[model samples]
Target: MNLFRHAAFEISVASPDGLPFSPAPEVAFAGRSNAGKSSAINTLAGHTRLAYVSKTPGRTQLINLFRLKNGAALVDLPGYGYAEVPAAVRRQWQGLLEHYLTRRENLVGLVLIMDARRPFTDLDRKMVAWFGTTGKPIHCLLTKADKLTNQEQIKVLRDAKAEAASLVGNITLQLFSSLKKKGIEEVEKIVGGWLNPEIRGEAS
Candidate 1:
């Protein structure tokens, strides 16, 4: 993927009678609130507002699906943890996320976005467990790489790799910064490979 020309749009599930099935291969982006998931997607897709940018954390309450030119789908899942949403609304997103992650057919891999400064939180571990159960490739994206020094970024990557190893066997970690546009090429290459039919292992 060029990382500069992919077209994307928001997707909504009008009815909950199971997810809207799409034949396109799907790769999901998931993380905690304020983890920069939307920013990462917008960076990769080369658009400022391809996905919804919300000021309130955990405002993304839907499993957003963006179609790529290669007939693949980029899914943006709701951020988990510490959202001030109502109990019932939170429960709805929780179930929706669980169902999509565990049951979606075209789900090829998961891009787990984590704040580079706080990479290995409890919520991150939980996501690892969920991805493990699904038996899909988990790509650990350490976002905000530009915010940290080079030494700190290296340390964070090392620690995240160790933690992910214990949680999920097949995992890949990348240093990313949506603001600086760092790691954009690397990530786009990985995503392009994952969307391809031949590459096995993880989408690193």
Candidate 2:
């Protein structure tokens, strides 16, 4: 079986204080609302519901952790930029996410999922800036690529790559489609590399 085929939900925490301290290296998935972050994880895990899928943009408001058989973990962070959610709730997530991203010691990489048609927005840029301070490797999956024509997908990939260098120091970009299962191998390899100490150097 592939390394991530058994990925299963371990826990969910609304605040940093509740975070479980694990010695295993962890890589997190984060993005704006409706960016296909959960779907990407489910696709990689070869499961239908590894991460909860919601039609509502802001329904996921917790930091969810998924554990692998190898003792490594994949974290799913709450999506940002959901204007309908209460301002107080959004502010709480801001603090919780910041603390986790900035201070978590086991974090080795961050997977930033983005919609191919709308790669980055004002909030997305803000997230890039915030994650930049961690100095960790970031891998961007331009999800929903199947929705675009080949030419359009290529153009978005080119543009996102061009902007990423200026935004994040250590970053990689690839096109993805959770529906069509596109780029699953690349995503798995990149994420797997991060969890494997022998090849983690290459991932970084």
Candidate 3:
């Protein structure tokens, strides 16, 4: 789709004031630290470094927003589950994330990135419930798919789907790998629909 041809970084929100208020539809990318969330963003945008908030893990402690050429917003939220970060700082991020998730008026959906090999943990399940309560469409991306064998991949995908189905409706799951640029188009297509629901459709 030549997504990069139309993609441009818009802004970075260190605090709530920096949050986008344009009322344009937005899809947020969220995951644990070292979970390949940043890599997935770069892949979807067709840019190798566009979403490189940091090469070192646990550094992107802000809500970074990128604007596509179509005027849709791609929000890169800071990674949770970083143990080295201070408890107070992590707590602050939790508060900030909760505020954004619960209060953002233009938020269209969430792209929950998870490590394919690891699958769901306690934190992921909780986050699923939290985002579900906000009534936002969520598409779970199982990142680093190349790390698993074909059979294992298929099993994990099925299990993840079943787990997610138990928690929320209107959810989509995709097998992804940023290294090989896998599932990039699928992610873009999903986000594209979020910004244009009339064209995307109302059903799975």
Which 10 consecutive residues of model 3 have the lowest summed lDDT?
195-204
Weakest lDDT window of 10 consecutive positions for candidate 1: 10-19
> What C-alpha lDDT values do all the predictions have?
0.79, 0.87, 0.81
Residues 28-87, model 3: lDDT tens digits? 888988889988888777777787747577889888888877777788899988888999
- Top-lDDT structure, candidate number: 2
Off by over 4 Å in 3: 2-5, 53-55, 197-204
Q: Write the residue-wise lDDT of candidate 2 on 1-204 in tens digits.
A: 376789888899988678788888988889989999999989999999889999999888889999988888888999988899899988988877788888888899889989998987888887778888778878999999999999999899999999897885578999999999999889888777777797766645
lDDT winner, 1 or 3? 3
Each prediction's TM-score against the native? 0.90, 0.95, 0.91
Residue-level lDDT tens digits of model 1 in 70-136: 7777878888885577788767776776777777777888898999999868977877777778777
Backbone clash total, candidate 2: 0
Full-model lDDT, candidate 3: 0.81
Ranking by lDDT: 2, 3, 1
